[model samples]
Target: MKLLLRRPQQSDIQALHQFFFHVIQDTYAKEGIAELVDDQQHEWELKKKYVAMDLESRGEKRFFWLAVDEESNKIIGTIECGEANEIIQQTIKEDLSYCPEIGTVFVHPDYQNRGIATLLVQKILTTLEKQKKSSFCLDSGYKQAQIIWQKKFGQPDFILEHFWGTNNHHMIWKRALPFQL
Candidate 1:
């Protein structure tokens, strides 16, 4: 499917929230496992909070990029970077060079394994480079995301095992800005 990487607008708010609640749930909440203490309600709130954060981040400062299906003209996925991740700052041992992190990334379940997420990520990465970000980081606990980052970005520098006091663990993957190379 053809995809267009576009900056989000207020018009996309409703659809974005719906996609986050349903499609994103399958990606984030694993069967019988979660740092949300396996609490469905907690996960619901957390997801809403992230969506709020995305909505609040429009035009400058934090950037949010969404991928739209050209044929369907619907938002299939989103990748966001912001300057407010205390966990990543602490985990990476230092704040990035004015660059914060890849915060919330989501793709619809039906769109999984379709290379859509990769395209979304690459689009955001390219946009971040143009914005002069010198470093990048993203957090992952779910198995699929952890694996994806490992393959796309190489090994993580930090892993907090049993981070949620179970099989759950926090993983942080980092990358330097291309201009820094």
Candidate 2:
């Protein structure tokens, strides 16, 4: 399938929400937490916020990119980034080593294992490069959603216990931009 990315728009909201739902469901199922939660409600709330932001904000510090399949014109995956070097520094009370933190990345099941996520990550890297940011950090719940990031990138910077403020463990990885000659 042909792959390309663009900033998310109003029309893609529904499909983006649907992709988010499926990814979360699949991830939870992989972690054996499906018995504990069905997160459609959370998805609805998130969708509302996303839509509002799409309407109200210009996404200055935050960048959201969606991967589109050329044939179907469908959004298969997304990368949400936050410009929070200072805020992240305050939260954990440490030096911020990375620029934008990868807020969320969810690829549809039909698009999984096709390197769509990697392509999206590369797009995000390109965006960061334009912003003159050298590296980015991403973290995920152990719910099988993180395997790809860990597999493709280096080992995580660290892991926190019950990081979701629940039983979930969070692992954070740093992806560095390739050196330009």
What is candidate 2's lDDT per residue for 1-181, written digit by digit as tens?
Answer: 8887888877777777777777777767767666655364575466456545644576764668888898999888887777443334444454454567766677887888888777777777777788787777766666466666667775667677787668677777655665221
Give the alpha carbon lDDT tens digit for every residue of 142-179 in model 1. 77788888888888878989985688788987777762
In model 1, which regions exceed 4 Å deviation? 28-31, 34-57, 179-181
Q: How many steric overlaps are in each model, in order?
A: 0, 0
lDDT of 1 at 159: 94
TM-scores for candidates 1 onward, in order:
0.83, 0.78
